[model samples]
Every structure is written in C-alpha cells, then in structure tokens.
Target: MKLGIDRGSLVAWDPDGEEWVVVGEPWNHDLPAFLADGEEAVRKAERTFTNPERVSGRAPSGLPFTPASLRAFALWESHMINGAKGMVAAFGSPGVRRLVRGFEAVTGRVPPPLRPRANYYREPQFYMGNHRSVLPDEAEVAWPSFAQVLDFELELGVVIAREARDCTPAEGLAAIGGFVVMNDWTARDLQWDDTRRGTFGGVVKAKTFAGAMSAVVVTADEVLPRWRELTGRVLVNGEVWAQSSTASPLHDLGAAVAYAARGESVGPGEVLSSGTLPGCCGLEMRRFPRPGDEVRLELELGAGKPVTVTNTLGARPRRATQARHTEVARRK
Candidate 1:
C-alpha cells in the first residue's frame, strides 16, 4: 500500500476511490506512535479509513514520512571519483599534494594517486542531514544566501522500519520499510568551501535545504521484485540532465544501511539515501541550475508507475520577508 501525508493528516491511497483517504491522525502528532507500531501501523492504515480526500487541489504534495533523521551515502564509484577529480582541480596541484601528504602522514602509508576517492572504495561514505529541512515534492527551493552554485542529486531513499545497530547487510535489508524517490538538493559552493577548509561536516549546511521526495512511499515488498532493475533520472527545465541505473552503484542499500548502523542506532522513520547516482549531478557535468529553473527527479521502481518529485528554484532569501514568503509559498 502507498502512504502519504495530506494536510497534516496521515493518509493512504484508496485505489478504488482514486483518492487519498485519511488513515490516521496528523503525521506530526502521530509519527512517533505510528513508527513505534511498525507494520501494525501500516496494516491499520490499510484497514482504517475516515475522511476520504481528493489530492487534486492540495498545495504541497505532503511527504510520505517525516524522517527522524536523514542520512545520505555515496554508493556510486563513478560519482565519487569524478567528484574527487573536480575538487582536486578546484584545489589546484599544490593543494592536492598537501592533502595527499597530510593523509599519508596520518595513516603512515602512501595514499593512492586518487587519495580521497580511493578511500570511498573501503566503505560506504555517508553524512547526516538536517531532518527538519525535509520538504514535499511541490515545494520551491530557495537558493541559499551563502551558495552561488546549486545542484540536484537524483537518488533512492529507504525508510527504515525498525531500529538497527551493528546489523549485518541482510538484517539491514530486512529493516527497510519502504522506498521513495529522493532529490538531494545541494549548495555546491558551500560544499566546496567546506571541503577546502577540511571540514566535511559542511554537508549538513549545504545539503539540508528543502530536499524533495515522492508523495507516496512504496513498501519493501513492492520494490524487492524490481530493486535491481530500478532506474533514476534528473531533468532540469524539462531537459534530461543525467540518467543512470540504480543497479550501477558500487554499494547497495543493504551495505549502506549496515555501514550506517555500525555502532550507531538507525531508527524507524529515518531515511537512508542512496547517494547521487553516476552522472546524476552537476558536479560531474559542470552544469548548475539557476533561479527560476525547475528540477525534476524520477525513480522507476517497476511498480507499474515511477515515483517523481519536482522543485522550482527561487532567489536566495536574504531577508526575513523573502524567507517568510518562501515558507508560505511552499505550503501553498
């Protein structure tokens, strides 16, 4: 069953009615309770229905789940290698040499030629994001005041169904509840600035802004049959910017979740994202989106229909007025 939030209420798609039916209480108040209930919560949504509502006039397409935490990983080798090369070029040869020397000194071993990207092959690289910044598909992304270059990453997101710690890949896979098409909006300029300063945590500020996701969540059972055949695409202003098969990633979702749960607890309602797919971002193509441009992401999960999310770029909110306006516009 597909689930979504509608006007602050938990809702499930009523295929027979072709409308969103109120399944439970408002998500903000019911999320914790629902997550604690796990599969029972889904079963309840399936059987229980109150007010049936049509989605025709809804402003922001409500999120399927409000994640307790958002964690994203770089699971594709091509994206990592190309991104590393871009950063190296930006840093210049002298800076790159110093970076390599610093790594060698710390590890007491000669670092590979592509020092940083090589490290990605050792394990899945992930970063925590601001959960509060999650947004619905129709939301407009305000250009961050501190960012001059903005990009969108096409990805698949897994919603955890249960708490997992020090779990194996198979266990991690079993913990997945559902999947969504994710658009990881990024402030490329801020990311570059942070990387140059040797502070990787800058991703929190760069990536936390109004990232978009599909309106409905598809259960694991619905996705498993087509998991290896999923394809992802990114379009900017109606033109295809990048395309890739989800199966092309070097690391799978299970490994990403296992790595994320190593010594750390990943709980239900937390989103684990399959990072930018190969060639799915401007960092690799040297092209970035500008204000007024529309970015769209689609993930074909072979569930008869593809999950899609779209966002329109707006100017940076440098003043309180613009900020409030953006917020109001997002809820339209």
Candidate 2:
C-alpha cells in the first residue's frame, strides 16, 4: 500500500480514487514509530482507510519520515565497471584517458582491475551518508557550491523496520518495512579528487551534500518478493536518459543489511540503498544534469502507481573570496 505524509498527517494513497485518506489516529507523521510498530501499522492503514476516516485533496507531499541513518551499498558490478569507464572518459587526465581508450580498443573490455573486486562478491561494501541532508521528492536540489559536475544516481532505498544486530539474512530481510525510489545526487568533480587524494577512501563531499527520496513508500510486503522483476528509468528535462532493472546484484539488500548488522545495530527508519542501478547513473551514461534540469527517477514495480522521485537542479552558487593555504602558511 502507498504511505506518506500529506498535509501534516499520515495518509494512505488511493490510486484508483486519486485521493489521500488519513490513517487512523495515533499514527501521526511519526513514520519511524509507525514502522517500529511493524505489521500492526500496515493493518491499521489498510483497515482505517477502508471506511475513510477523513479524505483530503492532493497536497504537497512530505518525506514519509527522515531517516535515522543512511547507508548506501554498491551492489551492481556493471554500474561500477561502466561508471569507471565513464569517469575516465569525463575526468581522467589526458594521458590516462588515452591509455584507457587504447586498452579498450585493443582488449575490447575495461581492465580487470576496473571490474568489481572479488571481495565485493564475498561481502557487502558501503559508505555512510548524511541522513539529515535528504530532500523530499519534487524538492529543489542545489548543487554544492564547491562542485561543478553534478550528477544523479537512480537507486532503491530499503527502510529498516526494527533494530537488528548480528542478524541472519532472512531476519534482515524481514526487517525491511518499505521501499522508496532514491536519487543520490553527486558532485562528480569533487568525487574524482576525493576518491584519489582524500584521506578517507570512499565518497565524502561527492555524495553527502544532498539526496532525494520519493515522498511515497511502498510497503515491503508488496515489494520484497517481486523486487527483482522491477524496472526503472531516468529522465532529464523530460527526456529518457537511461533504463535499468533490479535483475542482478552480487548481494541482495537483505545480505547487505545483514552484513551491516554484524556488530553495530541497523535501526528502524534507517535507509539502506541498493546503490546505483546498472546504467542508471549519468556517470555511466556520459551525460550529467545541469542547473535547471528536471531529473526524474521512476520505478515500475507493478505497484498501483509507478514510484517516482523528481528534483529540479538548482543553480550553482557564486564563488566567494578566501585566503589561500600558501598565504596562511606564509603569515604563520
């Protein structure tokens, strides 16, 4: 069933009627609490909406709930491999680009090292994201001032229903409360530098500045089993940019969550993303979103309505004057 916050109240979406029905009392905008209640919340939404406690016209949708924590895992090997090639094409130094092109021209494939590491098959690997920076669907997303090449990644976010620690994969799967379409906004230029030079190995400024999630969420019961059959598309300024699917991943979200819960706890309302879908990122497509572009991510899961997350890119900020490191060193 479709669930979200509408007009400051928890509501269930009726696709056929195109209306929002207020869920019963005690289920306010507290989505984490609702999810912590587990199956009871679903039953309440299902039953309460049956009689129509209160109905309202379509209003601006709000985030179902702010995530308690956010973790993104890179699961698709093809996205990684192709994304590497696209990076080399877009940001690699001239000599490196020539070498890569020559290597591809001769071998007809990206170098073996560029492929997903064998350890990726052995376990789930991920980076923590700034949960507080998440933007709602249809919200205006601004590029971070320091970045020039902004990009978006179409991904699936799994909402954790309850606290899990040292759990089995099945238990981890059971912990999923719902799923939401996710757009992981990236600063490609900053990411390139951070990836190679930053003391911290993985993405930092490139990813954590901002992200977007669908205003509505589909219950896990309705999505889990059929998730692999789902397909997705990315559109930039109303034009289709790429097509994708959830068909293959070295590790399912359940495994990723299970691995995450090895020692630390993965709590309710924490969002764990399935990383970028194969070919679903501008980084893989060789075209990035510019300011004023409307980037929309749509997922066809056979749900009543196709889940979509749309955000309009905002203009880059003007640079401000600042003292250089060299000047500071000289003064010291």
Candidate 3:
C-alpha cells in the first residue's frame, strides 16, 4: 500500500476516487504505527463507504515517516566517474583543469574518475547522514550560507521495517519496509574542502545541512520486485534537466543494508539511500540551480502513481564575519 504523512497524519491515496483519504487514526501518526498495525491499516482504508472523509486538496508536507537514521551508499560507478570530471571542472585549479582537458583532447578518451579506493569494489561504500536535518516534501531548500555552489543528488531511499543485525543480503532485503524518492542536498565546495582538509576526510557541514524525501511511499511488497528497474528524471524550473535509471549498480540494496548491519543493529524507520543515480545531479551535469529555482525529482516506482518531490531553492543568506583560528605568539 502507498501512504503519505499530512500534518502528522497517515493519508493513503484513493486511485478510484482520485483523491487522498485518511488511512486511519494511526497510533502515532507515522510508519511506526502503520508498520506496527500492518494490513489492519489497509483494511481500514479500504472501508471507504464506512469512513468516507476526503482529505483537503493541499498536498502532504511531511515524509511518510521520520527516519531514525540516514545512511547513504555509493552504489553507482557511472555516477562516480562522471562526478569526478565535474568535481575537477568545478573545483580544481585552472592549470589542473586545463591539463586534464588537454590530456583528454590529446588522448581522445576520458580518464577514469579520480575517486574510490580499490576497496570500493570489495564492499558497499557508505556514510552516515543527518536524519534530523531532513526537510519534508515541498519545503523551501534553504541555501547554505557558507556554500556558493548548491547541488542535488537524485536517489532512492529504503525504510527499515524491523531491527536487523549480522544479516545476510537476503535477510537485510527482507527488513525493508518501503521506498521513497530522496534529494541529498549538497554543498560542492564545502564537501570538497572537508574531504580534503578535515580529519579522516570528514563530510561535516558539506552534507549535514539539509536533505529531503518524498512524502509518498510504496510498500516493500509493491516496490521490491521491480525497484531496480525504476526510472527517474530531474527537472529544474519544470524543464527536464537529466534522466536516470536504477538498471545498474555496483552493489544491490540488500548488500548495502547488510553491510550496515555488520556488528551493529539497524532499527525500524532508519533509511538507506541508493546513492546518486548516474548523471542525475547538478555536479555531474555541471549545472547548479539558482536561488528561487524549483528542483523536482520524479521516480517511477511502478505502483500506479509515480513518486515526486519538489522544492524551491531559497535565497542565499547574507554574508557574515569570517571565522579564523586563534594564534599564539612564538616564544624566544
């Protein structure tokens, strides 16, 4: 079954009536209660004649559920390679950029992306994302005051339905509750700098500012069988900017969650992302959205209605005083 959270209430879509209907008085207003109640919620929603009250025309403003934690994995090598070139063009020094361009011109073949250690192929490469910062669908995307280049990563996120630990790929896959479209907002310059200068190559301010997920969610039973076959598009200002697909990945969703479960427990409501799809982000496409631009992400999850999330970029914040480290005078 598909569901959305509207003002902390669970709302299900009515395909026949072409409207949204309150699923039920969910125990807690989100996935936990819905998951806990299982088919009972669907059964209640099905009793339309008995409980017939259409929801307001206003769209849902919240994610189907609040994720307990967010974990994103780099699963597409195509995106990595193309994104490497974009990083160089956008952040590399002029001389370095020219040299790479010259080399490509001379060789007539693009070099491999300057990313990923050999171990990338050995296991799933992932990082912990800030769940607390996730904005609901249609929320204005606040511009990061410290960043000049704002970007977006088109991805598919999986919701965990139950606790898992030391599970195999199959078991990990079984723990999935549903799927949602995700926008992993990024600060290109900050991310580059943090990964290069911070301790252990951190991704702090670069990634944690804010992220977003579609309010709509399709249940595991409906999306799992064809999740990989899903197709998507990225639109800026209502114009299609890029197309993406989930036909290929270095590792499957099962492996990603399984890797996370190793030596630790992954609980219900936690989210796992299928990293940026190839050519789906501004970084890879070499185009950034301006302030007030509307960025939309659409994914066909094959459950009758397609999942989409849209947000407008907010204006950049005013400049502020620069921060500097304190210095101590040298002693003779």
- Predicted candidate 2 versus true structure: per-residue lDDT over 48-103, tens digit per residue: 65664456635438688889899999988889899888777777767887898888
Residue-level lDDT of model 3, residues 1-332, one tens digit each, is: 77777766777777666666666464555665665454565676667524545453334567777789999888998898788787777777678788888878998767644657777889998889999999888899888778767788999988888788999999998888788899999877766666667885545787899899998877777788887788999999998999989987899888988999999999889999899988999878778887898999999975576798888999977772122210110110
The 10 consecutive residues of candidate 3 with the worst lDDT sum are 323-332
Model 1 per-residue lDDT tens digits across residues 35-64: 455567767665654334433323226676
* Alpha carbon lDDT of each predicted model: 0.71, 0.80, 0.79
* Candidate topping lDDT: 2
Which should have the higher TM-score, number 1 or number 3? 3
Candidate 1: lDDT of 142? 76
TM-score leaderboard ranking: 2, 3, 1
- Residue 189 miss distance in model 1 (angstroms): 2.1
lDDT, residue 288, candidate 3? 80
The residue ranges of model 1 lying beyond 4 angstroms of the native Cα positions read 14-19, 25-60, 87-119, 201-204, 317-332
Prediction 3 global C-alpha lDDT: 0.79
Q: How many steric clashes between backbone atoms does each model show? A: 1, 0, 0
* Global CA lDDT computed for model 2: 0.80
**Residue 264 accuracy (lDDT) in model 2:** 89
